[model samples]
Target: MLDSQSILNVLRPVQDPELQKSLVDLNMIRNVTVTDGHVSFTLVLTTPACPLREFIVEDCEKAVKTLPGVESVAVDVTAETPQQRSLPDRQGISGVKNIIAVTSGKGGVGKSTVAVNVAVALAQSGAKVGLIDADIYGPNAPMMLGLSAAQVKVQQSGQSEVLEPAFNFGVRLASMGFLIDPDQPVIWRGPMLNGIIRQFLYQVDWGELDYLIVDMPPGTGDAQLTLAQAVPMSGAVIVTTPQNVALMDARRGLRMFQQMQVPVLGIVENMSYFIPPDMPDKQYDIFGSGGGQRTSEELGLPLLGCIPLEMMLRQGGDRGIPIVVEYPDSASAKALTSIAQQIAARVSVLALA
Candidate 1:
């Protein structure tokens, strides 16, 4: 019999790669229908940015084709991001399912670039994404995300004020840059910084976001501590250039997250190599090579992906555009996009785990 029950029964053997559980049992396969030897169903994934989306779809098709009287398989794909487990001492932002931090050990590792591009990539894949430039003193995300001149709308929600985030490239953004003049410098101490981060977490009108990516300041400091203590995080990603000094700092940052009980998702090696404009065929490891892999191996973490150095990458950031948006086909853009997918995939795994 070519029916919905037969469809589900066939799909029961297809497990989600990351969750390692049967798709039908996980409620990922739904709305099964059959008519005239034709089959159709919805494949609700854990994340829109799932790296194995094509593979999963193909697997489902193969499984259904084996059933009798099946002419074709039509799998409509969608995603429902799962929420991170809550902590007794920490509070979660309403409407935000997962909060992940993108951090580097010391500064100048292009952490903001990685954070902004990753956020945009997730949003590009049909996920509701937000970014918090928690680097209060260096809120470069607004400029990098093409929203430097934009301002956050403040509305009084009862007694306290709730911020309306700026939007661009399908991402919601909150940053000190929106509040300060271009030439202004923030000279606040730990307490002031802590208060503002808390406000960003609880006082922002981030309506129904799948992932909120926090761009943390370099090093293990007050900003990291405040976030760790204040909210339940899905995970944290460490960004570092392929050098000994940067790798040392990355390790320090990773340990801080582990110590604070936040799952360290993975490490991203930025500026792993340089690709000259004229010679796209050649790659030079100006920052040394294989350092990210070695460090990840030593720390027992996955190396998410490595990004190359290109003149256009820096130009895109300075010109208020992310490389992923400006040059999607370039090597650096492709790497960042893959890294973003990897991050989303990891978050899905963590949520299910």
Candidate 2:
């Protein structure tokens, strides 16, 4: 008979590509209703930014179509992000399902750029996203996120002050840039960094975020340690350039996370090559190549993606607009989006495990 039971029975063999399990078993397929000859159901994904959404839906459709009397199939798609497993000594943000740290061992590897665009891409995919500029010393996320002059408001909640984050490009941002003067430099000692990082993580009104992307300053220092010890992280993405020095730093950063018992999701190689706008057909590997892949292979971590250097990418950042939003068709933008999807997929798998 053409019923919900048969529909689910067919879909039982159709598994989530990433999780390698039945969608039905995962309880991702739900709300079945049959009418006339039409069969419809909901496909609830683990993350909104699932890279293979189309393929999963297609598989569901094909599976349902094989039923003896099914005339048509309709799958309404939705997502529910899972919470990361908490560590014994670490506390989780109340409404945040996952916390992702985007960092590097050394400076100037486009770590902030990756963090910002990844947050924007997740938001674009209908995920509730937040970004914390944990780069306390040089808080550029405000400028890059188009909130250069934006101020974060503080509201009294009980006895403590809670910060209200600035929002743009679908990603809410909490940064030292929003709290400090534009020309002023944060010259605090190492001991003082912990308070500010914790405040950014816990004292902000994140309000039910699926992913909170923390953009950490370069190096494995106080800020990185404070965060790992303070909260349960979904994973860390080490950003690097296609250079030996950057790769060396990335290794140190990855090891730090592993030692702290935080999952190192993968590595992101930015500025892998230069794609000159004037010469659309030409490519230049100014920073060298394959370093990220080699490092990932050597270290046994995933090489999430490689973003090409493009003039427009910097311009977009300077213009307070992300490449993913301003020039979605650009190569860098596409790479960033794919990396965001990969991060989300990894987070889901980790959460499920």
Candidate 3:
């Protein structure tokens, strides 16, 4: 029988490609199991999107196989993205591990829909998640989450008053929409916008969270810059439609995040296709096709998932229920869930790194 200690020794020589440190030293080796002559263990990677994942896996397997008594080596690769390294003058969110900004270049591409669904899906998967409607001028999260008439409550915490976030679909949510009357319009200047963004980020009592998804305003504007600079974001996801116009804006959004030193996690093509329930076999390219893929390829980022145009998706949003929760068995729901899984996995891995 090969002892766990012996297996650890074998893996000690295998270093993570990115970190260039022994796996043991990184504390990435998990669930070591030895049965007869076969040895198996899991390698917890820094990011599921790690470009060198294959290299590390192969190296780990080879190292274990070289042991004198080893008959076979089995390695499982898992990832957890590390928390963003704190930036100067910006304190980390209380109990938040990772922050993901969901943005687009132009509006009407269903960016908020994507953000809300992704947050709900992550929560459904047993992870603590928070959602922030950072689009101050056009706050729509309250309506989308079915909390349009809801108001943010205040709680006294010693010397400070914390804003309580609304809850629905298993996600904690903060939005200016909750505070302002639905019929009123916000005509604030840049300074006021910055203050609102800061208050939502720092004043809300978002208890320890696994992920905080920020639904960013459309375009590269002051609000976007304020949010990006105020938080040490783990990464960002660009949402676009399969149309040249949407793609053009999405490219700008991607570049903006990259320039701010925030990693572009991937691109999601919203409204990729439409299929009527009566005619399930035919697919309609309502917004043209391949724009998201082209943007992802041209920019060297991953294409996370393509969400289809469907009535269920719209109805779920209007009813304050995410499609991921309302129609988990539907194709659209599956795509959203898969994308959520990818985001969570990548975020966890990156956070660890």
Candidate 4:
């Protein structure tokens, strides 16, 4: 017969694919029993329809079978209730009161950078805001917010409690990167991915704020679906460059939000052109111009603003300070501010109606 303790020790290395933590660490392993070289256990998944059910079951079976004298394994999976899922609940975020998701159809068009600056601009305009870095696979908000090395303090009270968000530049922020090793790759399936997102939304201690900006990963996938289902998003901002390929993806992103019933806030064209500071008259259309504007026109959404390509924008993002904060008077910074103002105005109108 397999010793229970021995079985547990063997399973210690097995981790939840999404949370990137051991089942023991997450308290997901339950009701372990052993008899006549056979083992049975219950695995409490974070969600009922866990997308990784087959993978998890296979992993559990393999882990248990490796135990001395264990011949067979039976794993029963169940999900926790929503209330049971959330730890100690904090006061809901008040004051500035809207949750917006900033997303892109594809990567590398400066989506994360745009998200950070938008949050910063909103904060600078006197609206309290929070930024949730929802891009689990590529969480760059921490680096952009100058908090790559920061950690969120997890509080407990009877049950696991709120995970306090780190603060940078007056905006409260949280990211999966803060909780995981920087170099670790997050390879998770749909269900597990959704659960992690839910955990971030319900378990985090997000205080009063006017807006909670979620930086979504590129592509219209499980992450986007989970976010749309989890939160009543105020609107979505589609970021794209003035290139055809980027615009194509941006259009898909806009359509995704629309299909999910979330309003399309507007489109912002980043790297629209290169303007020399000295010449101030010469404009270089590096990636081709007006793609974003034409897309917005076709979709019947506003073209919020166009951000000129500047070395300062890249420098600021790389240095953990948004261009808006580093050089508020710069053209790119001003453009972002204008975009923020337009969004705020639109949101206000929506609230009134």
Candidate 5:
């Protein structure tokens, strides 16, 4: 018969799929028993409806079966309640905090880029901030924050656990991209998407954040609904290009937030114009002009700022260095910084009121 210690040694290779930590390290392996070449154990999961439970169980079984003299492996999975899953007496983020959602009607309007820079800028302003890449289908906050492909270490407290979000540019971040391969698509339905959003809110160790900026996916879809229902957002920032098509989409995005009773913070016009470095004064309206300003005015919202169409912005995003950080003195960078300050001021006023 395999000794309990020997069985544990074999089982050490088993990992919780979602948590991505060894069962042994997570302290999830419980009630290990060995008798007559039969090994039995309990696997405590973070959630009762944990989607990866079956995989974890199979992995545990396979690992134990590899041990000499192990004839049968019995694995039972159990889940902890949300309260039980959290550290003891730990309070969640307070109500005084603001949760802002940065969204767009369509993609490619630099929504994620704006989200990343805004979060970092807020952090730079000394507010304890966190960023959630709630765009399940296209999680780019990890990449924008220079944390793409980074794995966060999950810690356990008795029967509870918490995910440690990765940090970059002085802001804490959580993204679906971090949990799955970048090439793999998140083909999840509404319910599954809701669960994922909740997990990010309650399972991650986002301690004492003054603001949590959620980078929402484009469109008025299940992801947006999930965020509206799961968290009380202070406001939403709509990103759009200075074009009619983008403005139409921005209108839909703004209306969705308003319908959900989330405040429309303002509109940010991206790729507003292009100014070649050689001729700084010569400005070309690449995507046309005044769409963002018009949309904001029509929606009765503020035109927060306009981000120029610049190669550095794209290059910075691709390289995990936001233009705001890489070229703070540039016109576009300074514009974003000023926008960041304006957002901070607006949120601060709301907090006071």
Candidate 6:
């Protein structure tokens, strides 16, 4: 006879790779049954797109099979979208679970590109996602998401009026670009910048979101610092190119997040290499190579991915459809998707812990 207590004891050694917690300890084992020497149960996961799904399943089965009188093992795996377990609560934007800031040390490194696609990728995986163009001076999220002329609308949520965000590609977007003229420049001082950042968070009707990706302004400045302090950020994703100059600035960005006590999720190396259409067999080092890797090693962080320079990526952003959605099977899209998975995995692990 197979009982629940005996089954749980047998599976006590099985642990989630990311969270490092035993299945029994995490209460992931459910509906345990045994009849005629056959053992079956369900394993609840933190996220449906967990990168280590296979490993966890295999480990659970292996552990259960070790029990005596177990003829066959049947395991069903189910996942509930994990919540932001480790982050502090936001006062105004209390509906948001995870706040991720896609930032860099300097400008012109495809920070907006990375931020937009990552949000799309997470949404593609069946998670509710929102984006904020925190770069008040250069709010390109509206342009990137194909909402250049979109305007903010005021709606009554409960008692007071709230600003509504533009929606496209299944992601909610709010940016200063939609409110101001494209040709006009935002020549504002520091206090104004700070005030608008707060308004975007507190005034906007973001409703509910699993992850809110903030496309932060270039460089570490008052705006960046203010945003970090304003929200309870789950982590920060540092984007950089392989160029030495970009790496220098990227290092600063990584350290800035650490100094603020925000977890640095990982580093993404954009435009690491280029492959021309005419010569598919050969690879060119456009901005040098391994700068992201070197920086990740020095900082002791994970190098989430190395994206190559491709024409589709540039054209997709211009067309207002991110590469991840337009070219889901392309190499660039795959890299972004994998990075998103890693981010989800890290956040789920921390949340569960």
Clashing pairs in 1: none
lDDT of 1 by residue, 125-204 (tens): 89999999998887899889888889678999999899999999999999978877767556653459989899889998
Candidate 3 lDDT for residue 236: 91
Give the Cα-based TM-score of candidate 4 against the true structure. Answer: 0.71
- The per-candidate count of clashes, in order, stands at 0, 0, 13, 4, 0, 0
RMSD of 4: 10.5
Please give, for residues 181-220, the per-residue lDDT of candidate 3 as tens digits.
Answer: 6567566434688888888898999999999999988887
Residue pairs clashing in model 5 are none
What tens-digit string does per-residue lDDT give for candidate 4 at 68-169?
677788888887743354332223343537888888887877778888998999999888888989988878899999998887899984677888989988
The most accurate candidate by lDDT is: 2
Q: What is the C-alpha lDDT profile of model 6 across 94-117, one tens digit per residue?
A: 889998888888788888999999
For model 4, the run of ten residues with the poorest summed lDDT:
85-94
Candidate 6 global lDDT: 0.81
**Candidate 5's TM-score:** 0.71
Would you list the clashing residue pairs of candidate 2? none
Please list the residue runs of candidate 1 whose C-alpha ends up more than 4 Å from where it truly belongs after superposition. Answer: 1-88
TM-scores vs. true structure, each candidate: 0.75, 0.75, 0.73, 0.71, 0.71, 0.72
> For model 6, what is the error of residue 117's alpha carbon versus the real structure, in angstroms, after optimal superposition?
0.5
lDDT of 2 by residue, 214-311 (tens): 99998877688788888989899999888888867887787567645688999999999999999966889997889999999987899999999999
Name the runs in model 3 displaced over 4 angstroms: 1-88
- Per-prediction CA RMSD (Å): 16.9, 17.0, 15.1, 10.5, 14.6, 16.0
What shift in Å separates residue 288 of candidate 2 from its native position after superposition? Answer: 1.8
lDDT of 1 at 293: 93
- Quote the positional error of residue 333 for candidate 1 in Å: 0.8
Q: Clashing residue pairs in candidate 6, if any? A: none
